[model samples]
Target: MTTTYRVTLRNRNGVPLDVAEDEPIYAAALRAGIQLPIACNYGGCITCAAKLITGHVRQPKGTALNRRQSQAGFILLCVARPTCDCVLDVGVESHRGLYQNPFAIAGNRYPPDA
Candidate 1:
């Protein structure tokens, strides 16, 4: 059976996104038109790392984050799955003009159907 969790993230703009069930948190942000700075789509790079303000996350592969960071509530969007309804605060500084563009969109943006 497939598992899912609701995820909420606080962006640099202080905007929060309520992502639906079963989707990776990063994927959910992308769907919400939020571009999380990421280098590798995999867990190798920690660039997409974000701080978990509340809730649980499961990282089976554990590639995106080191032990210390994970223990400190840091999660790599590339490999993080919410174990419960969770909230995260973005770690990186968002590009100023990027979000202004209606064009700078997520590569694999697909939101759940209403």
Candidate 2:
């Protein structure tokens, strides 16, 4: 048997959307008709960054956030998969100034050549 978790995302307007733990939070939100701010869908941008108010999540290693940011409860919704019941504060104002272009990195650019 598999256990599924619930995710609650609170937008800037204080609106909350319920999501599932299986898929990426951003995709879940889109299915629910919630438009979450996102630039690169592959964890290359911080546009979809959110703070975990409560609960845990499993994110890809390529997420733009550093160790400190991850430990501080920051998560990129584009790559975040809930591990347990979660509550997230979306559209974090503090993160608005922390944008970094993933493509700017010399070797980390997307669409790697075959």
Candidate 3:
């Protein structure tokens, strides 16, 4: 059987979600009728970014985030796959300067300082 992990979206009034280990969070959200901001499905943009508050995830293809930013708990929902139950602050993509996004802190560059 496919393992499914539960994820709670903090911004969704604590709404919970069940996602498969192989499926990305964005896809799962869409399936659940939750519309989250999205841009490039290739994980090359921060359009679907979120902050991983709890649990762990793996985003091998999420290259839009620098090492420091990623280490700070940032996640690209479009590519991130949950490894366990987690909580996330979604809808942060529009808050450009609110969080430590690459363009907001590291300047406007593709590969920002890590």
Instruction: Give one digit per residue, the lDDT tens place, for model 1 in 1-41.
Output: 66556666555555655554455678778878877877786
lDDT of 3: 0.83
Candidate 3 Cα RMSD after full superposition onto the native fold (Å): 4.5
Question: TM-scores for all candidates?
Answer: 0.66, 0.70, 0.81
- Sequence-dependent TM-score of model 1: 0.66
Mark the regions of model 2 whose C-alpha exceeds 4 Å error after superposition: 11-18, 92-114
Better model by lDDT: candidate 2 vs candidate 3: 3
lDDT of 3 by residue, 67-96 (tens): 666766788999999999999989954344
Q: List model 2 lDDT by residue over 28-71, tens digit each.
A: 88887888788888888777888888998887754688765666
Clashing pairs in 1: 4-22
**Minimal lDDT window, size 10, model 1:** 93-102
Residue 66 of model 1, lDDT score: 41
